[model samples]
Target: MAEGAFIRDVASFEGREVEIRGWVYNSRSSGRIHFLILRDGTGFMQAVAVQGQLPDRAFQAAGFAPQEAAVVARGLVRADRRAPGGYELELRDLEVLQGSPGYPLTLKEHGVEFLMDHRHLWIRSPRQHALLRVRAELIAACRDFLDSDGFTLVDAPILTPAAAEGTTTLFEIRYFDRSAYLTQSGQLYNEAAAMAFGKVYCYGPTFRAEKSKTRRHLIEFWMIEPEMAYCDLEQCLEVEERMVSAVVARVVERRRPELAVLGRDVSKLEKIRPPFPRISYDEAVEMLQRAGHSIKWGDDFGAPDESYISQQFDLPVFVLRYPAACKAFYMQPDPARPEVVLGADLLAPEGYGEIIGGGQRIHDLELLQARIREHGLNEANYGWYLDLRRYGSVPHSGFGLGIERTLAWMAGLEHIREAIPFPRLLHRIYP
Candidate 1:
């Protein structure tokens, strides 16, 4: 137990003696020789203790009955190609710290319900560990992209008095004297900040009370949104492409090992580079109809339609300028065709639909007020928002990127639950 020695540092102590105190992952005894795989939170190491060659105390301590028993070992590190990590340890001393009884998750199959119930322990598994590592990389890549692009990171209020989008999916929480809802999107507040900072973004968790049972929906999820002042929908799409491309590039560069663990082909991610193909809502409807999908214009694309349209392109494709009636109240109407909104959805390839939803917002106070009234929303609730337009408003656009969905696609996970450590689904929310 040297002052500066960690379990991972054992590789540097190769061919020399060292001590690693950790829990046993598993152990196999073959009468004459014992092999124990130990993990100390930093890395895993294999320890070998031979009978008649070591003291009786060492052999007894290494003879773990159950897999997860805790023990400390003093051994000599040696390089061996037969070992998984190319390093092996010959034990000199052993101490049992804690004795573990029968474990639930063994080297066998379990039902999805059982696994979800034990998600607290399931994250320690190799697959989840690899998935979380990739998630960390994705978050870092997002921050890196926003920071490098001159976008200031601004945190929005979680508890709000009124809904910015609508009251349909609001998660109401009892406040001191009134009811408050979790912020669904930070776009409205980010728009106010954009007037001051020119470009601003918010990255945090959003909540919805709707009972959705789809692979693409989460009751609570993280969103990364960027708002640009004086920028139109075209400029917003350009930034979106660059930001997403930068994130994909970082994952490719840093998480090659993690991706390999999840059995993902890195080339699928490498195709996420610049100039993602763009198509209009009208074109998408036509393509879907041609592809045997019966989706007509003026209808929001469903999951099946999204998958069909996304399948046509190798990388993520942008479906822009949807019918204005289907969009949120904040979307700006197309000047040429007032029936279409200046919005876009970035649909990921491989059937990962709608990772990003964003568009230009109405800058004129009159138009915003008219849209609000037409949508049957209370004008009093949005008085402060309309003030942004009354004072000095410029064309601004932004988008929200769902973190869990993006991570699921990036990690090639079969389900979105695998991406989140503790998922809050419609039917279950525990541990």
Candidate 2:
């Protein structure tokens, strides 16, 4: 028995016998020869078996093997220009480890609903596999950029006593007879950590009980929130753009084949370097009106409005300084314009919508208390948050970037659901 090798590394064993253990992705048998396609999560390869060369049982196993059937094949690895990984297996012996008959999915096109229902199986498909590969790369790029920049990771709690955004969109739960809510964002806790570590970030899953069933929305998602002490709105924008550029470049470089599998234009991603176009909220409103969108100042722009604005740029666009009423209470009020906050939303191009949202946080104790009361939130729940501003708060800024949304944009996916492995939508939560 030859030592086993993955299909990806099978080329190294050329002209030598090796064992490959994987599930049969597909198989086709003629009268004298059979071709077996094998997938082991790493990659796929082809195995060939000739009737006269292998035992009768080996030929029988190869001829009638079912899709997803676990199998092991001892074969001589050979170079094949026509194979998936530029290598093929010449089977000398074969054994069916577990015959998986009647697999649910096929190599044909399936409806979105049907595929989503079988998401676990659907992920094995080429497109899903590629999409998720890029997603993993983007996450690594994010951590790489932040860690290399001297930011300490400070994890945020999932169960929080207070809402980071608002109560209306919170998922309420009972924790030992007391009401608690799933965290909407980790920006607030990152603020405290920033004071301790000077630069900090929180990367974890966050919950939003929003009833929105839009393609761009998810019930539960992962966000990366980075906070920096002595950072202002402009500086936050620079940091955000740099991070976005780094992640995009990484996905483009490492996941080029994956991007191509998803039909994404590499040129669009290559133009995603830093120095993305910037426009004030007022300017965005004006641009929207000129573009025939029925939006006005002080009103938050909807998907249609955002799509129109983002389409004006080749890369991500920064829309900054939104009206205070439309933003979270923790955002710092603009020193020059008290009615607006030093906030920003980074809208991805190609109509993918907002992928990041953040701003300078309020650092004055009195202002923080007033904003909390103004927003009609309970004061007792925010005592710890307010204490940060009371003791010694510097002008700090941060933002929350949704992992799924960013993945969708990078992979050119039609919906955010495909970006995450097991997505939680407003109406579906199983599997």
Candidate 3:
């Protein structure tokens, strides 16, 4: 048996015979020459098989193997600018491990629902492969930036007794004799972790039971929430800008090939630097009103409003100091303007909205208690959370960056569903 190699590393094996084990991406035949495209998850490469060089059976296998057929091919690698990944293989032998003829997905156009129903198989396509690879790179970039910036990773519980964002979007479940809900946000727990470790982060899947079906909304999504003790809203904004810029830079540097595969405009991503444009909620509302939107000052922004605001700037824009009544109860109210809270929502450019949402949290025990009462939350369930304030609460700030939304923005995906491998949307829960 020849030495085995992955399609991604085939460039290093030029002129050397190696065995590639993967699924057949595509195949075509022209007279005596058969071209086979193979994908091994790492990347895609083309293998050319000549009828006279290989045995008749092997040539037939190469020519007849259908899409996604499991196959092992031995070939000598060569540089070919015309081929995928700028490399191709001169096939010496081909063996079909398992024939996958009559595959449901083909080169023909497919409806979104049909494609989604066959998502288990749809991910095998080159475009989906590129999306997944970019998603992985973005996730790694996020963790690397946080880990290097003195932020400790702390795990938050997936199941909790109370709502963190709001009671309206809680997924209730039975916890033995009592009831529990899937966590909407880990911010409340991260607050406690920040108090202990000074700077901490929690990265995991969070659930929101929203009923509306929008291209930007996912019922289950991943989030990276970072909390910093003794950090105010301004400091938090600084960290947000730096982290966002760093993550985008890393993706641009390392995942260029994947981004190219997705047809993303790298020049747009290259412009994501520090000191993003910041405007207050009042200014945003004024701009929206001037632009003929029917939004008022105290009302929260909808998808259309956010899209309009984001489109006004080239970089991610921060809309700060939203009305306290529209934001979460934990947000610290601005001292000078009691009606608005010291919170910020970082909206992504080109119509992707609110990738990051966070701000300085209320640290005073009395004020927190009052907010809890005002929100009509059960105080008994939050006694442990209240203990953090009673012990040693300091002014702190943090934010949650939705991984799917951020990846969608970075990858230039039209729907947020493609950012995740197996998306859980309002009505989607299959393969």
Candidate 4:
């Protein structure tokens, strides 16, 4: 290894010899010139190997290096307008550590199932790389928004005594002799944290055991739940719009290349500013019915339903005030309309579907207790949760923005599975 230069730091070594360790992503050559494309995870760069200029060992290694083979390129960095990442490696020497034989993935079209089955290897592709980068930026931007806004980070348990959303879609676990379940949402714990810290958020993995095969559903996924004490429904919506806009701005500014790689229309993201359009559930239902759907008053929105409503707006639209019976047990019912809860679901534009669901929480102990019992959940299990209302309850509000769903919408990806590095679906879980 010469001079120990990483591909990302090659600009500093311009006109000077340096070493690059990476895997061969691609290769092409005429009889006289060989172009070797390499990626070191941080970035991709091209290394040129010409005939008669290299020693037999170096020339032979570069000429026949298979895709995915491990190699080290000793070269001088040079600026290239046409090369990837705006730089090229002039190979003076080449070393192949290990050769990959008959790599399965080639430059051909593969079905989604086949690609997903080979996802462990398919991540090497440019689109997959871009998706991963956008996902990272989304997470970073979310944490930045919350942390800079004076929101404390609180860790939520993966295992819980009772489900946050409901028990129907919970994955129950046998904990020694007692029964526990994987957390469906971090909302409840974020609530308790908000009461203690004034404002708090939880960013972690959440599980949903529903047997959904929709493009937007994932059995295991990540969520960013921001809960604020003394915040009303309107303030919560403001926080949501701000957080989402910031995250989208980060992706658009820092990840333009990644977005281009995914073929995302930058204009759509450029329109993602604050003061997003808001409509009521009644309006959404009317819109859905007008769109030729037979949706009733109390029914929730489905994928097609959300798609129709979202297509009406260019920015992420918030549909507020769902029927109390259709919402979670802890959602606060609107004082003016006892039948509808003061909740909201942010549906992304262009049929990306609902990426956020949240609302003001019920702070009254008796009301929460009645809701719990009405929902047929065990009261004894919610004693600790009830204690929050009993001890010092404030009108707190929060919302969870699904990381993968949001990433899919931001990157203009077709499937939500591509948003995460290693996706866990209802039936598929492997390498």
Per-residue alpha-carbon lDDT of candidate 1 for residues 1-431, written as tens digits (9 for 90 to 100): 42224566777888787778777877888877889988776667788988765689878767754677777778788888877688988887777877777877775888899999999877766677778989989999999899988999998888998988884589889999899999998888999999989999999989888988988888888999999999999999999999989998998899887898899988999888889999999999999999888788899898999988888888899999999888999999999999999999999989888899999999999999999999899999998899999888999999999989999888887889887779998998988
- lDDT of model number 4: 0.90
- Residue 238 in model 3: lDDT: 100
Residue 374 miss distance in model 3 (angstroms): 0.6
Runs in model 1 lying further than 4 Å from the true structure? 1-10, 52-55
**Every model's TM-score:** 0.95, 0.98, 0.98, 0.97
C-alpha lDDT of residue 347 in model 4: 92
TM-score, cand. 2 vs. native: 0.98
Give all candidates' CA lDDT scores.
0.87, 0.90, 0.92, 0.90
Look at candidate 2 and tell me the lDDT of residue 180: 93
Our tally of clashes for model 1 stands at 0
Question: Which pairs clash in the backbone of model 1?
Answer: none
Residue by residue across 1-431, what tens digits does model 2's lDDT show? 69988876876889999989888999988867999998877778899999877899998889989998999988999998887778999999999988767888999888878888999998988788888889899999999999999999999999998788774589989999899999988888898899999999999999988899999999999999999999999999999999999999988998898999999999999998889999999999999898888888999999899988888889999999999999888899999999999999999999887999988999999998999999999889888888898888889999999999999988988889998999999889978
Error of 2 at 174 (Å): 2.1
**Model 4 Cα lDDT, one tens digit per residue, 9-70:** 88888888888888999998886788989988877899988877677778878889998899
Instruction: Give the higher-TM-score candidate: 1 or 4.
Output: 4
Clashing pairs in 3: none
Q: What are the per-residue Cα lDDT tens digits for candidate 3 across 1-431?
A: 67999887887888899999998988889969999889888888899999888888999888889888999999888898988678898888999989757899997899999999999999998889889988898899999999999999999999998898665588999999999999989999999999899999999999989896999989999999999999999999999999999999999999998899899999999999989999999999999999999998889898899999999989999999999999888999999999999999999999898899999999999999999999998888789889989999899999999999999999999999899999998888997
Worst 10 residues of 1 by lDDT: 1-10
